[model samples]
Target: MPRVSQAHLDARRQQIVDAARARFASHGFAHTSMADIIAESGLSNGAIYRYFTSKEQIVIAVCEQGTEALPKALTPEAVAGFLEYVRARARENRHAQLVAQIYAEAAVSPPLAAVVQRQLAAMRAAVAELVPESRRADAAAIAEAFVALCASYSQQLAIRGDLDPAPFTAALMAIIRE
Candidate 1:
């Protein structure tokens, strides 16, 4: 058999992750099974298992792949734009729904919770770095609130359907600017 290139291997792994993401987004993680992921990816069971030994590992991969969209600097306009960008992606792919589901799953699953806490800590650290010198004293608190607000927005988007991000952005800015 011809040796598969690393790129090909990565692509196949991504394909599995993508399928699992879609399934988990549409059907809660608990509801989505390995069989469902296999069917969704149109790949054999062996192929899926080859990349991820279990659904939990695939869930970890999806969580690890989440994008960090924090603004480069702390500013009202940048924050608003970030919120809008999140809303757009949520509408396009229902990724917000997936995140909301992950949050729920993390409540009961210790491993998932650990992965989520790590990601949240990283995001908070990144956001804290963007705090203005004047607000440096409150950077940690602000970062915590900022990250929470962002996750809240995702939860809102998932539960409330498409919403005007302006209000959510306004709320976030209030906490940020305060």
Candidate 2:
């Protein structure tokens, strides 16, 4: 038998995660089964189990994939790039619904809820870093505005089918201009 490189292993795992994301998005988490993931992934039971122990484990990976490492500052150019990233993901993988599904599942699952809470805390910390020293008095408010801006886009994107990033990018740029 030949050995597989780490990149190949990671890619294989990502394939499973991508398939699971689509399945969980189209069909709610509770309704999505390992068999469904297997069919969606076109991978056998052994292959799937080799990567994730259960649906819960895969869901955790889904959450991990959804979360990005927030930069110290979210500048206008960065917001433009962010919108482009979201647009491409939505066009190719139904990214918005997958994220919505993750939140939906978290509401009912404690472990998933913890994962979400931790992610949100990390996000807040990152947003805080974007606040200028001069705005220290209003740092909390400023960070909250950024958080709300992100939440607004996320919620709207999940529901809107227009696939237009113009408005989103504009709004995000407006924040950066502030």
Candidate 3:
């Protein structure tokens, strides 16, 4: 019997996820099939299925990829860093087209809707922590506004291939300063 290390398992899973992300980004969630991902990964059905049973699960993983670009802390500096990160991604047209695709699909998919709701809540909580205690009542709304703005910026990149971002950055800083 051979013992496979945990790192090996993680790497294998990530390999599948990376392939799924590329396929989904290039062709979108609705258009990309599991077979496409399997082919893209150059792995067999059993190998890819061993990691993700369905294309929806793989889409969720792709959604999870962008979460890291969000701020880890509630500090103003971290928020600024997050804005810059979005700006950089927008300039690149971003790997996050998959995220926008998820949003579009979430309207019809309950599982995806729930995933998005959970992530949005997590983001709101993180942003709320940055506000003063007395003003926290508006934190959730502000967080949603920030997310929506970022989403629009990301979507624009898909068409234009570049976003000026100065206006969006000013608006994001205003949200934080408020």
TM-scores for candidates 1 onward, in order: 0.95, 0.79, 0.83
In candidate 2, what are the lDDT values of residues 63-98, reduced to their tens digit?
977885454466666665766676666667777777
Query: Which of 1 and 3 is the better model by lDDT?
Result: 1
Q: Please, what is the whole-model Cα lDDT of each candidate in the order they appear?
A: 0.88, 0.77, 0.75
Question: Could you give candidate 3's per-residue lDDT for residues 1-178 as a string of tens digits?
Answer: 9989999999989999988877887888878898999999998999998888999888877777657457665455665677667667645545657667888888888888888888877876776666657557787777788777767776776666666666776787677567
Best by TM-score: 1
C-alpha RMSD between model 1 and the true structure: 1.2
Pairing residues by index, what is the TM-score of model 1?
0.95
TM-score of 2: 0.79
lDDT of 3 at 18: 88
126-178 per-residue lDDT for model 1 (tens digits): 99999888889999999999999888888888998887777877887787777
| Candidate with better TM-score, 2 vs 3 | 3
In candidate 2, stretches whose alpha carbon ends up further than 4 angstroms from where it belongs are 1-9, 69-74, 163-178
RMSD per candidate (Å) reads 1.2, 3.1, 2.7
